[model samples]
Target: MKIDLSEVGRPQSPGARAVNAMTCDVEDYFQVSAFAPYIARDSWPTRECRVEANIERILALFARHDVKATFFTLGWIAERYPQVVRAIVAGGHELASHGYGHLRASDQDRAAFDQDIRSSKALLEDIGGVPVIGYRAPSFSIGRGNLWALEALREAGYRYSSSIYPVAHDHYGMPDAPRFPFYPNGPDGLLEVPITTVRMGGRNLPAGGGGYFRLLPYALSRWMLQRVNQQDGRSGLFYFHPWEIDPGQPRPEGLDAKSRFRHYVNIGRMERRLEQLARDFAWDRMDRVFLPQT
Candidate 1:
């Protein structure tokens, strides 16, 4: 996504601001769906598990900044490391689902998708001791072809979602979708809070967090977020993985050039940039940022 650097000098949001959402997709690097080609799910037990240590680093960072975020956790990790899940809740962060086993909704049939959501939600709520009303599909997998996922989410008792990335991508994106939160296909009362994007040249460009944040200059990311809040009057939902903050974690072999580049290019710089992000804006949980007033 091309950012119009001209907006870098834009002013902050005017009085009465909406705090942007800060989120973490709580999955270990080995569990990344993109690496499925190189890593075997059954072998997940053999790989060195870094999610617990990485999560603690993230939790300490948030605590240092006094920021509260929503953690979209994988059911597999939560089930194996229930203490880590409990720690997230005890740290004053909202816990939500990132699906079981990181399976994409597009890759699953309706029955499988339904089972994934129900079981994941049950596990999260059971361990975290709170309702898991928010969910984000693994890798923003819900798109134009899977609007049925929205209905299923509502039926599964999910009140909101942040699963659709509005910008175009080789793997996942709904380019024509709205940049901010909206009800996809008019699914009644089911809010689909898309990842934030900036509109320019009549096309939506992804400015929200993820690999884009890692690839872009911090100044540009900051500018686009400010533009979204100050000019568009919207709350930005920024997301990243706990693995993003752990540069020293083990790197799997046999990765293609593109995969290796995308995953490892700037791993060393993420934590410091995240520290700046934590201080730059007021952050809150996803539900509080997107949910409507009574």
Candidate 2:
């Protein structure tokens, strides 16, 4: 999600202050299953204990800061860790879908993608005890080539999606879409809450937290959130994953040197940065913050 807290409701609301939403991308150790070729999906079930331990740390930190968040969880993880999903719900966090197995929505064709969304949503709602209204594609996988994914997301009953990143990147970013959240006309009139970025000098600055947030210094990340909300008159969506906070997660072998670096770098500082963000801003779950007027 974007983090431009200070610039939100600027010229638009004039003096209104916008609310920032915090979200977590929940996946099991094996669901990153991207490195599946190297580590095999079957082996993941055994590795989840470590993932669960890390998530507990995150939950404790959020409690300390009194931040309510949304967890877009994979159905597979929900099925495996029902207690984790229950805990998230009991803590009053919104439960949203992060697909079934962390597959890229863009990578799956229409029929498969459609099933993935339906299955994941049903699974998360059943386990988390909340009507799931939000979705975030695994790895920000929606782009021009897969614009059709929005129609499917709408058809599957999602109201808002935090999957677009309007920045140029090798894996996932839609560079020209609106920088802030807007309804991208789709079957369900999907609201695209893009990962935050600032259009500067014709280039987009990475303002959304995740790998970018951890890679950049905390001062810069926090300042960018304030700058976007204060200057742009829109709320910033800030998201990170439970795994991101776990620096000691087992590293998968066989990823290219660069892939390994991007996935694992800065895990050590992620939890601290998250705490700082919670204390600095008013963060709520997406279901609570993204309500549109009828």
Candidate 3:
């Protein structure tokens, strides 16, 4: 089923000062980086494409709450559906880069990564008619080992990146990374807004939104983000994908139990939870919340 968030008035700024940087990674379900092992690139075309339907649902949800967010878009998606990119910008949201082809920065070498960043930024800017200053790597792939990606992003004219996850995970994360925004490449380095994580019991906990937000109860996710804010005094940078709100989207066959569970868990509950979240806190575009004003 398709839901449309268009025609609704853009949400006004929340009553409180900005509390968190809410972001959405603009990629379809079939484009998830982890699924690359099971789903072939060629096969993506053969699968059902429901990104527009899902994007509408997300946009509608944000419209109801009057939340303006940053959408980290994929170059391929923009190339295919420029209107979707235009729609997002038209709705008072920011357009950022989610990299072309949705490939992780750590997976590609310097040359390939350079090309991907530049091309994606150029495509998004041309289509959205806005400066794409923020980038989030696929799967939070730019960790300590792939620090070079930061330089590439800086060279590409991006001002900040919500790419590093400071939690321990098999696919991607830098457990020792800072939980808040910082200059990773020294003072001249690109601004790094590592996904929000709380240091608990001597370990970095995954508090940034994703599967963790879906798999765990909404109350817990809310509490963690709150703690990151009220106690830690930093904006909790949260992110999710268009697919997270679409439960009826086609599920590819043969994915293992773990992958299946991660992708499919609690989708039905997401929309309602997002509504509560919108009412529960103040949210703004990543750039406004993280980037320094002149």
Maximum-TM-score candidate = 1
Query: Which segments of candidate 1 are over 4 A away from where they belong?
Result: 1-14, 185-187
Question: Better model by lDDT, 1 or 3?
Answer: 1
RMSD of 3: 7.8
Give the poorly placed runs of model 3, Cα more than 4 Å off: 1-18
lDDT string for model 2 (1-294, tens) is 222212122233766666788888998555663465677666666664565676688788889988888988888888888889888888888889899988898779999999999999999888877899889999899888888788788888998888888898887787887776666673237777888787679988888787889898889888888887788766778888788887777776678887677778888888888888888877888867766546
Candidate 3 structure quality by residue, lDDT tens digits, 30-124: 99976888899988777887888888888998999999999999998999889899999999999999999988898899999999999999999
Error of 2 at 189 (Å): 1.7
Give residue 56's lDDT in candidate 3 (0 to 100): 88
Name the candidate that leads on lDDT.
1
Instruction: Flag the better candidate by lDDT, 1 or 2.
Output: 1
In the range 1-294, model 1's lDDT, one tens digit per residue, is: 111111111223577565889999999999887799999999998888999999999999999999999999999999999999999999989999999899988999999999999999999999999999999999899887888888889999999988888888998998877676676545355788889899999888888888889999999999999888888877888999988988888989899998888887778899999999999988999887777647
Which runs in model 2 stand beyond 4 Å of their true positions?
Answer: 1-17, 186-188
lDDT (CA) for every model shown? Answer: 0.87, 0.79, 0.84
